[model samples]
Target chain A: MSEFDLIGRYFAALGPERSDVVLGVGDDCALLEIPAGQTLAVSIDTLASGVHFFADCDPEHIGHKSLAVGLSDLAAMGAEPAWATLALTLPESDENWIRAFATGFGRLASAHGMRLVGGDTTRGPLSVAVQVHGLVPTGAAIRRSGARPGEAIFVSGTLGDAGLALRRKLAGEPVAPELWHRLECPEPRVALGRHLRGIASAMIDLSDGLAGDLGHILAASAVGAELELERLPLTSWVAEVVAATDDWSLPLASGDDYELCFCVPPAHIPVVERLSETLGLTLTQVGWIRSDAGLDVRRPDGGQLRMPARGYDHFPAANDGAD
Target chain B: MSEFDLIGRYFAALGPERSDVVLGVGDDCALLEIPAGQTLAVSIDTLASGVHFFADCDPEHIGHKSLAVGLSDLAAMGAEPAWATLALTLPESDENWIRAFATGFGRLASAHGMRLVGGDTTRGPLSVAVQVHGLVPTGAAIRRSGARPGEAIFVSGTLGDAGLALRRKLAGEPVAPELWHRLECPEPRVALGRHLRGIASAMIDLSDGLAGDLGHILAASAVGAELELERLPLTSWVAEVVAATDDWSLPLASGDDYELCFCVPPAHIPVVERLSETLGLTLTQVGWIRSDAGLDVRRPDGGQLRMPARGYDHFPAANDGAD
Candidate 1:
């Protein structure tokens, strides 16, 4: 059978049922009804074998990570998940592999209320490109340029577990199962992001580490920040790992956390805290936005702390793989 | 500089200015205001190096073809182009190459009234995946499943030049400049497609050759067709090539033509003819849909003609590239 035939058999039936999707996989284009007075939030991400994941990684994990990364962008924008299109390139058509991959992708898609609308299957080196479309009220999307001076900076959930897991995996050292899971299938805080929409002033997802992604918000907003190192939330395992290695930089600059870092006014802190309590998810205030020019790292004793690296970079050298 | 930095410098400013796009690059997600009562049509296409094009082909042509193919899907759906997201993977960061590519892509985007919203830049084997979003009136999209028996089959423009060009390029034979141009930059019939929205019964873009793509519409609509070999609209050069080789299969099975094929009722034939005159495009009625099951080709002498291979197959073996 042809590549198109394979997709029609294994992937076409995986989409969620939604009235908004007027037409789906069979057509040259998928038609979706965008409700009145709503804006569409769109983002695309490409994950390549040996670059974004291990070449020998599980196909199911590859599928999950591919969609999760793109959905995180919608979460950061505080948009309601709606539809997605996938462009998959493979070295060969493996029926079992495609089935597992579809299952992994379909499960996450159903949970988030997003439907697979259309896609293309091609033969090439293994790679997956996912473009997600979501909806938000017109002019109501939270952006990266709304932070102001004196606003509190916050992040949802713990950090650095994925980075630690990557380090251990690369070194062939023993790793905790939780850390491994974080490395393989990082959860996107979609619900928390949607809840924080009108509350947060500026927001960004931490795919490229806290320091770097927050730096993006600051640069866009024309502000700066002072992060209190001790206030950074970390799990017991991460804390222990950092202490054992005398390296606290992992939590500060580790990429692939996929948690949200946002800023809000001081007056809204109570409401945000109440939201945190209601959702039973950690929303730690790690820093404050300032009118100054650049980011500063501060110790609890009022001394200055040095940064290790800015974050993960796709083009560190000419021959390296992308993030 | 990093890959993100490269994108910020080169690609961020390439987006067209559109008020519907609330946000462009440099954000977690790009927000687009969908006009009330309009449905969004979306399609994605990926062009991998050495698979879709020669590994050493010009980057400018690669960039143009990448976006054009996705736009053709919108044209086939009778949707007005609106926005696009590009996920580009490159083996290395070549500043000059990137600048030319951006120029080629930006020119077509501006012409089509589509804005570049958001995308990812990655390092890997070179590939360009473009997802295009277009707008159409609610419940007005042209679908492949709407064709019926007794409708006349029509196609816009000439066919088989791209296929002829490919064959010449592979065999190290001399090719006409026009044929080479057609292979590199076949125009998508966006305006004509929009005009045919209410007139055509069923529509699809010719990507995987006429026979294969027309087969898709037949399978969806549960109908058949009879094509007249002598009635196929062809350029003088393609006719000469076919006569010299004593093979008409090139025009019948050549991919990458990027033309529109549709079925119109007998009553609408006059309207289509008027449209063709207005657009100065060739819209030749080459066949008719039938109640029978399979496609039949009739020669000038009323003799039945057998088809050649059913167009390009991505997985003919395990090592071939996708069309």
Candidate 2:
């Protein structure tokens, strides 16, 4: 089929029809309206097959994860997801694969009321690049550099269940469907992020694990952090995986959880409590920011827990990345 | 080097710094302020090595052309280029290669006062995805469906030089430096497109060759076109290639010419002429829109010139994408 035909069949109408999109798919460019007094939060991410995902994995999960990761970035900035443009590189024209991918993508995008405004489909080794645009009130974006020394560090949802799933699968062991689902379909904390716009002083998405990703917040804010290791949020599946693999690094330094890690000053903790109750999400306060300048992970008994040797780097890495 | 270090070394400061960017590369999402009374125009395109260009070719050109193509789409909408996000996937961390690539990308972006607000760099087979955001006055952006039956069709710049260069390279023949340069670095018609905002009824960027790309305009506007084949603007090199290769398809059906194809009402011709002179660029009138609903290419003797059998398709096609 022609490139245009493939685009029409799978991607012409994948998400909600937002009124903000003036000229959508099948245009030289998509024209959109950003309301006055709002800032545009834009993020671009690429998921390369074999590097980011296995080729044999379900295409639906690939589609879901691709948009999820970019939305996660927007969520980090307390932006409401608006529009996305996809540049999909395929090895060949496989209608079934494309359809499944679109289904997965459409479901999440529609749920967020985000629209697919533009796309380019081409032949190559499979890679998907998603650029998501979101909106936040002018000057109200939560940046990583805003955390203060006395702020309480909080992370939404369980840590590293996605990485734990991959580890179990790679070890040739039986994996729970729940664990695999977490690996495949991460929920971007869009609503909670927007609600925390004024309450959270700093925010980041947990893509590169809590220990490393939170370090970004510390480095940018020029503050230190002390994490209570026992308070690290976990699912039963993650606990089982950690006990079996005997590796704390999956929860500490591996990647792809897609959860929001943020800091709330002492006075805002009450507001966070009200938000957690309203949103019905597990908002765990695992640590606090300090005046000193380094990350310290503590044991329940108060000695420091040794951190991983390296963070998950996509290139030249000690981590296998399911290698 | 670590992923963070790689980003800082190569991409952190690769484009012009603009005041509109509230937060740039290091943030989870780039925060940009789009002015009130304006609309956002967005476009995304990907170029994969060995699919779009030779993998062994200069990375600098890859960087330049990647941004050029997306900018061409924005230009088609008569939008002012503002920001670009690069999602670069490389096979390895070759610092010199990345530095050269950044230099090429930086040059074009700075020339237009555009900034690199965000990026994702990861290990994979070489592919570059560029998403560009530009601005146009509310309801003033050009669309492909705006042409009327009596409008004159115009195209900017000489056509087919890029395709001819690729054809010669693939045919194992010596290619001119000028022609090869066209293949590597085609200029985007940003200024002319912005100038034509109120004047041009319809517009498209010629990424695919004249005959095929022009067909998109005809199809969208639901009108016919009659082209005076002799009036097609061409460099002497293109005429030489046509004579030597005896392949009209290079000029008519291949891809990668970044020229703007547009329609102007007869009354606006004087304005176009004035702008052309003021800008010191070639703007050729090649055809006129008709009430009928198909395209006709008339030879100098008033006979029809039989068009090529196929237009370029990125997948399942007769044309080698220089394949």
Indicate which candidate wins on DockQ: 2
Chain A TM-scores, all candidates? 0.95, 0.95
Candidate 1: docking tier: medium
Task: Provide the TM-score, chain A, model 2.
Answer: 0.95
TM of each candidate vs. truth: 0.96, 0.96
Model 2 C-alpha lDDT versus the unseen true structure: 0.87
Q: Tens digit of lDDT per residue, candidate 2, span B1-323?
A: 65667788878886777889999899899999988899999999999899888989898888899999988999999999999999999998887888889988998898888899899987889999999999999999999999999999999988888988997899999998998989899899999999998899999999988887788888889988888867878899887766776556666766888999999999999999999999888999999999887778886667886443234677765343322
Fnat across every predicted model, in order? 0.80, 0.85
Question: lDDT tens string, model 2, A62-159?
Answer: 99999999999999999999999999999888889999999999999998999999998878999999999999999899999999998999999898
Q: What is the i-RMS of every prediction?
A: 2.4, 2.0
lDDT of each: 0.87, 0.87
Write out the backbone clash pairs for model 2.
none
Indicate the residue-level lDDT of A73 in model 2: 94
lDDT of model 1 at position B100: 82
